[model samples]
Target: QCQGGYDEGAGGLLVSFYHLVKLAALSDRCTAGVMPPGEAPEEVRIKVFLERDGDLTIPTLYGLFRGADWQERETFDMYGIQFAGHPHPKRLLMPEDWKGFPMRKDYVQPDFYEMQDAY
Candidate 1:
């Protein structure tokens, strides 16, 4: 998961998970996603953005389960993407008791939170 900057001056934060399958594939090195995670259901596509000197490349795979089913739910909740074959495709961040996507860039941060100490 990654968080883009709120202001134009700050660079965005990029977060990635290193799965055991990936370690085995890369023989223990870091990697990045070349394509967005939503592209393929049967494969996990990752791009190796950085590696030891003389070793850098993009790679993709067709068989890898990186996490529990709920993990995909969290990704969906935060990023608003559907994992085609994931089980229990339900809201994981917003309460089942609430409404609408809260993490979207356009979501208005509630003024009450912003103004609480001003009064």
Candidate 2:
């Protein structure tokens, strides 16, 4: 199983989790003729919506799926979705001290970078 995809959902008010299982099928098909019986793995999707004006927090999948580490961080970075129990819960795309989630519906982009140095 792996974190196949993640993105801001519900018009930037939600965070979705798309999990993919048994990615080995691609390799198996390359070497084998056909998958026998019901050995094929099924993909699962789970969506969790949080209050737009409340704490946006959810349990981290990093413990079960190592592939979720970066994805979760990206969600936190871009959507301000907090991942509880994340080993390294830091920004993946934004600076450590950056303010506001740029992808959030209520976010207002600043006219200038606060941390930018004068030329």
Candidate 3:
């Protein structure tokens, strides 16, 4: 469970994962949202895991932060990040049934590799 979920939506780092927090049913992780007194909504970012856990599943904050709906969807589409209670856990930028998460650090595109070799 998060230590706090009251500051708009999420907060700081643990193990150096500023916003990539992953939670287990039996694990404890915290998440929150903050900004300067007058920051724009676009400045808000939802932190997930520290990139430590092997499993990347987490609960969605769409209920508390409506803005998260689209951002979560996009993250899911590109990074394979799963939000457990998301209202619509659909792909925003990729076709439905797309293979693999492209934004994850480990992802490797065949075309990219070929292009790199050509260069």
Candidate 4:
């Protein structure tokens, strides 16, 4: 997968975890791939950009999952990359009723939160 800002236009490819692991192990530079979660196979795999700062900075990805559940939900929670055939694609953090993906660059924080103030 290409980095966040780098748009190589993947044309939509279904990347497997095994492939990602192999790429990460073989290459020193960062790579990107799509991870799908749950029974729903309709989800699209967006390209992700890995950051050297430790966190995988996905420019187009965003969300809030509980830190305590990181290990169990890391793939789906933070990255929003769904594991196509995996079971249980529910909220890893926050309440079940929570609306919208908070982490996306296009996410609009309602009411008191203003986009301009974020900078």
Candidate 5:
């Protein structure tokens, strides 16, 4: 399982954060609603930082986590963070021809009249 898989503009850099959990370690007791002492799910936190002016790319985790397909694409669409080797690195929440990433801190919203024909 993964949580908090998103990007943010931090200072002059774009940072992406992901929290991953190894379900196998805690699967047996997940449904029981109780975790015995000394039993903890294996977890990892990953952070990828990219330059604002340089290439904003990171290795795709889709190969390891199949569910990450849309997450990566959304990140790309919103923050312009490219996931290298992603099978379908297309927009998930925006139009194919949309201009500029919407979630970047420096992003300037375009005028509605300017986007009338972009659809």
Candidate 6:
């Protein structure tokens, strides 16, 4: 019924493949929302727990949805949320060797901006 909503016998939140770049941070966590397609579109939100240094790995939908491939990659490139099991799982925007997650609230601005920068 909802992304994090109660579903009988279904544990854990259901993920929605998003068309919107609705990424945000909490006190110690991050969240993103994507629209799940159906007879009509429904909103789905995922709340992720930040691991050491703010790394978050989310399940990939590449096997289920085609568009997920690019969106998840872009999300990973921008927000640093790795889409686990994604076939290509590569950066869609930043350079391949770029360090740190730019979208993260606490992501430290690397002093070597001249070398690589999301700015």
Question: Candidates' lDDT values, in order?
Answer: 0.38, 0.72, 0.51, 0.35, 0.78, 0.54
Clashing pairs in 6: 18-34
| Residue lDDT tens for model 5, 1-119 | 65223434545778777788887777775767778877788889888878878998889889998888888888888888888999999999887888998887788888772445544
Candidate 1 residue runs with Cα over 4 Å from true position: 1-21, 25-63, 66-68, 109-119
Per-residue C-alpha lDDT of model 1 across residues 14-88, encoded as one tens digit per residue: 222323333343432324734344442232433222221223222222124434455555644653444565547
After superposition, which runs of candidate 5 have C-alpha atoms over 4 Å from their true positions?
3-11, 28-33, 37-39, 113-119
RMSD of 3: 13.4
Worst 10 residues of 6 by lDDT: 1-10
Quote model 3's TM-score. Answer: 0.50
Q: Which should have the higher TM-score, number 3 or number 5? A: 5
Which structure is stronger by TM-score: 2 or 4?
Answer: 2
* Regions more than 4 Å wrong, model 4: 1-80, 112-119
lDDT comparison, 2 vs 4, better candidate: 2
Q: Indicate the TM-score of model 6.
A: 0.52
Which candidate order results from sorting by lDDT in descending order? Answer: 5, 2, 6, 3, 1, 4
RMSD to the true structure for each prediction, in A, is 14.8, 4.3, 13.4, 15.8, 2.9, 13.6
**Weakest 10 consecutive residues of candidate 2 by summed lDDT:** 2-11
Encode model 6's per-residue lDDT on 8-79: one tens digit a residue: 122222223334232232211322443333323333555544443344676876776676777777767756
For candidate 5, list the clashing residue pairs, or say none.
Answer: none
Instruction: Using TM-score, rank the candidates from best to worst.
Output: 5, 2, 6, 3, 1, 4
Please say which candidate is ahead in lDDT: 3 or 4.
Answer: 3
Candidate 4 to truth, TM: 0.32
lDDT of 2: 0.72
lDDT of 5 at 16: 72
Q: Report the alpha-carbon TM-score of model 5 versus the true structure.
A: 0.80
Task: For candidate 4, write residues 5-89 as lDDT tens digits.
Answer: 2212222222213111234433434234333332222223344444322443222222222321333244444334443333455
- Best-fitting candidate, scored by lDDT: 5
lDDT of 3 by residue, 1-117 (tens): 121111111222112112333333113222244334543332223444434235556777777657677777776676666679988988988767567766555556655322223
